[model samples]
Target: MTAFRIALLATTVLPVLAVAQQMDPSMQMPGMGAGSTTEVAPPRTSAPAQAGMNGDHDMGAMRGTTSSLPRRVGAKRAAPSPAGPLASHNAGTMDGMGGIEAQREMPNPPPPPAALSGPAHAADLVYNPSDMATAREELRAEQGDLRAYRVLIDRLETQFQEGGNGYKWDAQAWYGSDINKLWLKSEGNGTYRGRVEEGDLQVLWSRAISPYFDLQAGGRVNFGPGPQRTDAVIALQALMPYSYNVEASLFLSNKGELRSRLEAEYDLLITQRLILQPRVELNLSAQNIRELGVGAGLSTVEAGLRLRYEFIPEFAPYVGIEYERKVGNTAGYARASGEDVGSFKYLVGLRSWF
Candidate 1:
């Protein structure tokens, strides 16, 4: 029983001692009244004191509180922002963040889009029909230029033929100056007539069908004849190893009559410029020998061999001999009229051209 009482007493005393220890010494002074709650000013609220201080207050522990008091009221705490657009409007009006008045400081409005532009800029902005038309015209001119060049190439390549075959055409003109002679004679008779004659000009035209053949036409004027006899000749020439030429002619006289003559020659080339030619000429007339007294009647045949040496490829000198025979009424006229009708002839002359 004594032990229990002692434990109870110890517990009560411990509580009393804790209460005494917590009491402020200054409040416990002699004049202080006991058993009364003294009214004390809680430490003034501080800028950060509210944040740091807990409810347990010791007035004696407040150091640096006086100096820490607001110098002026802290520039008023920004009110909690109102919601949404209202807060944005209030913020925009604040002097620190200038109002819409800031727009007044901007430069005047920019000029039109043309103000700082170049041709490329204009091109981008432009749309017009005239520009399209100019482009089309340029394209057409280019096409025409290409076509013209093509035509020129075709002309050069063709050398000009009737068809599209591209075969070339050629024409040639030639002149031959010749001295001619004829001798006429009657077979089985002593009568003979001979004459020396020459032509002033012989003009010919020829078309080369190929390398080997030629088609020819020409005319000759016999200036040696006082009456001016002329002849038109047609021929075909074959260029063989021994070149062969055949010609048919119509002889015209002052008397207004036409006589046909055929002549053929074979030429053997002895050199590039020299040739040996064997030739034959036959003459026939429409009338009896009595009509043309000088020509020894009607049918005449002459054959000869000639040697021609070309001084230039286009010119040559020739010497030949020919024996001629006159037949039919031509022999009769010559016998009765005692006219010089035909003979054998040896002649020299030039065969030439340019």
Candidate 2:
């Protein structure tokens, strides 16, 4: 019975001691109390007591650090933020505050040319060098420098006239790559039963000066029944606005004579396979050539309207009406020669290109 009473008394006394420690500061264990080595904050003042003090009493300066306070917890201070470019948005700018990362912000200069790093042909390493060279050359040729040729029989037509029957031809063949070509152009008119009246052949070096035009410089040789001569020629051939094909040529004859010719033609599609083409050619001479029945100023002008059915784009047969006029002094020369100054003829022709 004495042992049970002693256990009960011990439990009651322990609770009483804990309550006393919490209610009274002086009752706490020695090191944990207000007078211990660790500093203690000043006792807090009641609201009325704080109001009676001077407003500028500088309470924070007098109070000790709250590190000793009860019912409070402590945390580690945040690490100082990095101070360079990645620190803030303004760190990479040019305004005196920015670092190296800000000064040259353009994309890293294009990775040093990938082209020049290896052998001229990497295949050369694994294949027979000679065969590789040959294949590489073929690739370049097919890509850019390949040679090609085309023959365009732009005009091959026979004419029926009150005076007589005649044929006319204007054709060109060119051989080259896209930027440079050698051109052969020929044109002539003659009666069916007689000799060629006027004809010329041109050997030109043509260079593409624009996407739509070529500038050609070459030599021309006149042939047929007329006075034979050689001329230096410079010409422009262009596909102009609205799909108009234009050719203008200036010629300086061996005899110091100058002449020019301009031709323009346009195709109007009536149907995918049927087309109407209206074309004009003007010939002008700087001076008269009595031997050739030519005169100064405008020599001749011809205009034609043709309707063609293109069975295939590479070949088209056309039938057309043409009006030809001899102008200025050339008209007088034609009259003197017992020829008509103006005439209209109907013709059929085939246009082909390859």
Candidate 3:
């Protein structure tokens, strides 16, 4: 009976030991059997693991002492910030930071003057005084001196009338500058009967009053068969509009007689060298001066139309027809003197000027 009990206990204990040997050591519990030990691994650090995952771990921090404060996952240490007060301001905001602010502090250049701003403003350009003086001197040197004397024989022609052939002449000469002139004028006519019908001579001071007009003040002497008279004369001579030459004169005789004359002439160019000239002359009187064959009101009117071919600019030969008539008391005087009150004539004349 003792041997049987011992054998049963040995068999059970051997089977238990074999099962314990097959179990894993980590899975084994403490106090499970004799010679078994319990072990606790050091707590794992999650920071280094998280740092490695985020790829932002600082090498220096990794080598330095571990920190008790938990490190932020995926957070980066910021770069060293700029050092001044302005540095903290955003580059895009208007806190007076950055290149834009620097530009604002700079002084700008002034704009150009209006006169120098464009091509159209060139008229306002200024010239240096020295340069202007030099230009004026050069111009004066180029011009030289002006002429002091001039002579013109305006009419040295003869006219023949049908009833009583007659000859006529007019001439003038001047001395001095364009603005003022000393003038000598002469005009006369002779009848076919060997008698000097009318003659006049004048000395005038002429002044330019306008571009196309001259004012003449002078003394006139009339000499002929009937009577001789001296008169003071004031005259206006002009190159009128439409290229008409006009002369108007008022005479105050020494005896207080007043007389006036108006004459106008125009040349029509049929060709460059061929011209037709029409002329009219009117004489008026304020009182009868029967001694001079002059009467009051309209005394005489003469009209002529002449056609000439100018062989040269200074000379032209003309053939013309002229009509003369006496009016008012002048016509009565003509009849009292047994002279014709009206007359018509064919004329051939030379018109020459110098």
Candidate 4:
């Protein structure tokens, strides 16, 4: 029994000594007499997390020793966040609000000065106003909204078809402002040594309806081989999406004849100066005006493809293949007169504008 008691005391006493040795040197033992001069052992080597937990304690004078505590006063503070204010941006929004302008109505801006709102000729202020006015008048006449005239010889060429070689011309001239214009168009075709087979002149007034189209109203006079005729014309010229050009016209003749025409063209660019143009035209009539050799249904269609190279933008020389066919009653009339109803023609032409 005496040996057993000795072993129990040894075990308990050794463990208590070991725990005391591992504690911080300065910390006092609980329930132990004060000023005993017993030295505490150095801290034991342990895992970092265990060191942190062990380092944190209620012991006075030991609080600053923990590695988790900030060394400098400001080091523990988080960074300030952004306010998303206008000055943080380029200082202004498009509506002219600056700074933190939320929920605030923009104040009315001051009106412009009288000089800024008046005629732009500021020379009138320093020089003789009348002389400056006269100078401004001359400038206005030579510039801005005044030089609105264009004359184009769109096609003036000869055709080489299966039957015989022929020549044709289509030209237009217009003079006016952006919104309104007087337009003249004429087209005629004839055999090289023969009379004009078909010809017409249209004198029209054109009004812009949209950015891409114009509405035109006018008169048309048909001349040449057919019966002399006068007709009222209404037309539309438009630039369709994908850059197609379209023209449609309705004609009501003095003899109560009704007819219509539609034309469409597209330009495909092979290079900066090379272009391929494909064009198609259809003519229709509601009644058979036999005197004009007209059709009751569809009358005619002309389709052509041309490749041109521009020397200057205003001048291009072209070579093309064209197919012309007379249809319906018009074809019957053409056949009765022994005229060729359809043919494929190879043509060379100059296209120009000034």
Worst 10 residues of 4 by lDDT: 69-78
State residue 26's C-alpha deviation in candidate 2, in Å: 64
lDDT of 3 by residue, 23-59 (tens): 4333535545434443322235687775665343333
Ranking by TM-score: 4, 2, 3, 1
Runs of candidate 1 exceeding 4 Å displacement: 1-242, 251-256, 271-274, 289-291, 294-298
Candidate 2: worst-modelled 10 consecutive residues by lDDT: 67-76
Q: Cα RMSD to native, each candidate?
A: 37.1, 15.9, 27.5, 12.6
Per-residue CA lDDT of candidate 2, range 256-298, in tens?
9999999999999889999999999999999998887789999
lDDT of 2 at 82: 57
* TM-score against truth, every candidate: 0.35, 0.64, 0.59, 0.64
Error of 2 at 53 (Å): 52
- Clash total of candidate 3: 0
TM-score for candidate 4, residues paired by index:
0.64
Off by over 4 Å in 3: 1-145, 148-150
Q: In candidate 1, residue 225 scores what lDDT?
A: 34
The order of the candidates by lDDT, greatest first, is: 2, 4, 3, 1
Pitting candidate 1 against candidate 3, the one with the higher lDDT is 3
